[model samples]
Target: MLKVPDHQVAGHQAGHGHPGPLIDDSGRFYKPLQDDDRGAIEAAFYTSFSSNTRVPDHIRRFFPVFYGTKLLASDGSGQWPHLVLEDVVSGLSHPSVMDVKIGSRTWYPEASEDYIQRCFMKDRKTSSLDLGFRISGLQLYESEESGLWKPDRKLVQHLSADEVRVVLKKFVSSNSPIDPNLNPDCSFASSVYGGSSGILAQLLELKSWFEDQTIYHLNSCSVLMVYDKKKELKGESSDAKVKLIDFAHVTEGNGIIDHNFVGGTLLFDKVHLRYSYQS
Candidate 1:
């Protein structure tokens, strides 16, 4: 929530302003949060995991762990906007990141109905993709030596080599039939989450067929780049590791598209350009 002057917003929209918690000179991010529904939600989640819908389980795996919520008092706005959350990446060793806007963008000052429809669609898709971060950061690999479209050499990923290999081995060794329609591994790899944008025409199509979900956050700037080798020093658990940071504009919806009209999907290539992937 850094003070955004009247004009410095993206596409001239105040809502599009820095969508995450504000970071001051010291790298501290102030996030506003709330959780009165936790008990009810947790009770419902226990049953949801066993359901065929599979949304709860998917959320548990890929969504950032709720380290609990905090209540805050308002100082300036005159109204008590008690919604404050601790920025997920506030204390990571080296935090750098990017986000993928799932649907279309209408960055103009006043968004049109079509743009609003697409933006809502993006929110739904994002909530589903919250599970993407859970698949394992090991599936993603970025080198420290800077290059085009490269995530920061020291950027943190959801999976590590050790973590992903275990999952990969299980999948490869499994005798069970892997459903081609629901192959999240391949689909996520081709997603903005996995960071590849080479052949999007097909990938976007694949996204529609499989790996459709939501993560809540809406802005493309919600992604974080956090890399800390010695992050867990004192009995710290992996669950607290900050994956994505912002959750300002969250929504849920199910929309279908005949073609891949995703305008501002943040592919890794768009973030960093490597020699091999560069055109």
Candidate 2:
């Protein structure tokens, strides 16, 4: 467990030293997730994929390796917001951190603040995917023939998770889920070729529930991937785990469920954008 001051705490003047980035793109946290709120997050990582299945550690990012909070003694300054967070993926050699955030730019940031909170705050009614506005992507599937993952050169592409999810949802909703229109980057294609469908099925579930969220990322959110070299060398079935980040622009209730705001399916077809695998 690492104690970090929230990103908002920067330049506020403090007695403690700044624990800078563990790796590049590492952000600080001045606010804690509260002791009571910790359980849900942990569960989100460990047991939250599907209500019925817990993904194996080799391929799953169910929570950080270490997660918890510690109260710091006040130094007569301001309310110290040092937060406890899991080392989301900075422990590996030359590891890759890929942020996979869900939602659209227009709807996420454009939504009013009141609506954003009400919609994003997950109660028992919301699925875990919608709660965090994130989903695991099909990052692992690449091609030697016409695809992205070559023996060299890692990739970090930009595309909306909203576009990916909605397009996939519409595709799977039809009689033929794996049709020609489906993007090769869609996890469905890989699931058909490989097995461990439990993961793909869970992702499909994420797509099905995409409409439930009223808010989404306006500026953009990231779905990050972390690499495990030792695991791969040992021939662990999986080598990476993915998680989401950058909630600065996340909004709530921008698009009502009835409207399916921003016409995601329509946008998906228009964009027709999916990139290659990373290193």
Candidate 3:
């Protein structure tokens, strides 16, 4: 891609004096927490997505499934470093948006113009969420023998609208760390990612429980803001406690493509036009 200083971005290797987040003992970033296996996953992805992407051997070997939005950073040093994230707000119309509060001070640098420029705009007012541009998730478990957290059985379960709201409230209100136990029921076990499905499908599968319900769209520009966690659930230690993450997609005349696009977009436009004509 576009050649620029790495320090100004999120996930790049700035050789030295970089003050951004560092990899922990488990080989994951501490903040915006991500698993350690992401490095290689990202490298392979970059290589395939673009001819110019350079995947560092060390990073590729270290992280197997780096999820979320990646950017470059300088870390106050001259060296450019990569900023691997767990979840970052990035799509077609917006920059990689970071929600941060630095001890009462919040810093959110504008998303890269280079990255944002790459996204396809649908028209003057609308833009497509870059389908090629991706975030990360687990693909396969390291091993069942290891028995910690493997991607082998990645599944997505749907929650009712009310259940989804509860999950969102749990995530947004809590200060506790991410609990792997926070997930849907056994019904969703079948729809997890596989060789046949795309990331969007995997994400959609995760929310299949809320079918036929009106999923409220709180923020059209950013999906990250839609999920909120419960503040009270923090002190407990239970996987069944039910934490919520936002999975807002497939709106009328919106970012993603689905089977309904052709029918839905036209119908929505007609209905709107009819109403406007009447008004």
Candidate 4:
């Protein structure tokens, strides 16, 4: 049976008579196709990406495993097409997830003037213009008893650089929630974001690929980070995962370097550096 995903930590929600993401019992994620060209564009990108042999296997691992599309019964009588993807957080007891939208500029050169203007305004209003990324949404699991700590999406999107740092620290910390006074020790930083097999390393691998490949320019895409908070609390080894998602705005590179995507990856490197220094 398809149902609302309880493990969803971010993105458009299913409510108020609107259809959103759904998941099946087989650990497959179902993202409802948008009503605009974005749906077709995203479907094309994934279809092409999956078949492209030029993309290295290691880098391809960073993207959600696509299983094509399916027409599923909607909330109403109509059937909707949903992109079937692997549920990145499947099997986690308590997942802590964050969706960080990368890029200083989200709109592509081919976008309409009005669309560009809207994206420009949004980028300036958020930290994306200055910081090269913005936290679209996040949810940290406190415990089985306390449940998840999810802040308002609007507030998270508008956070300053300093505030972002605090939130990043809090995500790795097993202490009290987002309180600065009761600062956490960030015990999971080394395991989750550092080390040879950590998120930083994975992102660096992606950056290396983006530094060369010119096949696609991913605009307004987010890097989804996930980890099992319950395992961290139990002193188990970190199992952090990172995946690139949301390809509605992807465009062909036409042999030109994707400076915007590269810049976003570099910004993530900067974030890791600062986080390391502070921790």
Candidate 5:
């Protein structure tokens, strides 16, 4: 286990090397959920998704891999924010089901993806075309009464066309390569795509043909805003609220396939939103 400064010593300067009174001077303490903690978290997260049969057949193929270490120091309540793949996935999953139980219950195939199929009218009518995938988008929120973090059940809603426009516009306009939509670019997408997603924002436009709804895109982004439960507006409470996880990629150039070195897991077969457009 690696040692980091205690809470008192880690204070304001903990994340950085800045010296200040808020620095926890209690000698070196272990970073909460360091590399050693990753295995547990990964297993926990993977298991949660694996066990849940509700996950779509296509998505289950790409396993969730949690990057970085789970460093656990102490929170004031004697609890450390448990960092793990399961926690993150669970955070996105549980609240999603509670709000929108994807599949047939909420959204149907024709009502969703606008993409047209290649099969002739006769084939389309007879063939069992399974546009089976569904996306349950959710946002992580701070709990007021618990004082501990819990998924705010009310945050689920259909992605508005305007909101989608904003995310895409920001992604294309931002100077950073990292699609600020998702919290952190996945290791697979980054590893396979290339570039430092954590740094250096670059601008790119959406490749058309991908605006269909059949493909369930799950992406996250880091929230640069200040954290305040009271200030946050919920989905039901406000239509202007944004998904704080990460930025969704916006493609350009007639919306055709365009490739760039990206980070994190990109399961090209199913989840490749880079170029494949339906309809």
Candidate 6:
């Protein structure tokens, strides 16, 4: 049976008479197809990307493994098509997840004027313009029995750079109740974001690919960072994973470098650097 994912930290939710992403027992994620060009665009990107032999094997690991599409019945909404994807957090007992939307600009060059204006306004209003990335949502695992510490989406999206750093610290901290004022010890920083297999290293690998590849330009895409808090507390090695998600705004590169994505990724490197030093 397909059910709402408890681990989802961002994007639309199952409310307001609209269905959201669903996951099945087979460790597959089902994302509802949007009722616009975005759905077709995303589908095309995945279909092409999966078969394209040009993408390096190492870089391909950064994205969610695509499994094509499925028609699923919704709650009084009849049958709807959903993109089937690998559930990145499938095995984690207490997963901590964050969604960081990259790029200073989200609209494509060929986007409508109204769309460009909307994205521009939002980019300025949020930290995306200055930081080149913005935290869309996050849920830190407090405990198996205590559930997760999920803040309001609006509060997270509007956070300043300083506040974002605090949140990043909190995500790696071992503290309970998630106190904002408590100085984070960053017990999991080195393990989760520093090791050879850590998020930083994986992102750098992705950045390297973006530096040369001109196949596609990903706009408004997010890097989803996930780790198991239960494992960290148990003194296990970090099982951190970084995967790119959200391809609704992807466009053909037209043989030009995706400077926007490259710049945002570079800024992300700086953010990690600051986080490491400050902690």
The candidate that achieves the highest lDDT relative to the unseen native structure: 6
Model 2 over residues 1-279: C-alpha lDDT tens digits? 333322111112333442332212343233332223333443333222333242344323433333333445444533433334445543343332223334322234355787456545521122223323333232221222322221211111222344444433322121222345654333332222123432233333333444454433223344444443234334453344434343333333346551332232223223321211110
In model 1, the runs with Cα more than 4 Å from the true position are 1-53, 56-62, 66-71, 84-86, 98-210, 214-221, 229-242, 245-251, 255-266, 269-279
Q: Candidate 1 lDDT, tens digit per residue, 128-238?
A: 233222221121222233211222222222334243223332221112113334322321122222333222332333333334544221333233322222222222331
**Candidate 5 local lDDT, 15-129, one digit each (tens):** 3322222112232222233224333533344344456665554434223333333334442423343323312222121121111111112212232143223222222232111
State the lDDT at 25 in candidate 3: 31
lDDT values for all models: 0.29, 0.33, 0.25, 0.85, 0.24, 0.85
Could you estimate the TM-score for every candidate?
0.34, 0.38, 0.21, 0.95, 0.22, 0.95
- Error (Å) of candidate 1 at residue 13 is 15
RMSD of 5: 18.2
Q: What is the Cα-based lDDT of residue 259 in candidate 2?
A: 30
Every model: Cα RMSD to truth: 14.8, 12.7, 19.2, 1.5, 18.2, 1.5
Better of 2 and 6 by TM-score: 6
Error of 6 at 92 (Å): 1.6
Residue-level lDDT tens digits of model 4 in 69-173: 998877763688889998888777578998899999999889899999999999998888887888888898886778888888899999987777777777788
The CA root-mean-square deviation of candidate 4, after full C-alpha superposition on the true structure, stands at 1.5
Cα distance off (Å), candidate 2, residue 223: 1.3
lDDT of 3 by residue, 137-254 (tens): 2111112233212121111012222432233222222222134565422121112111124112322332332232232221111112111111112332111111112111112223
Q: What lDDT, from 0 to 1, does candidate 4 have?
A: 0.85
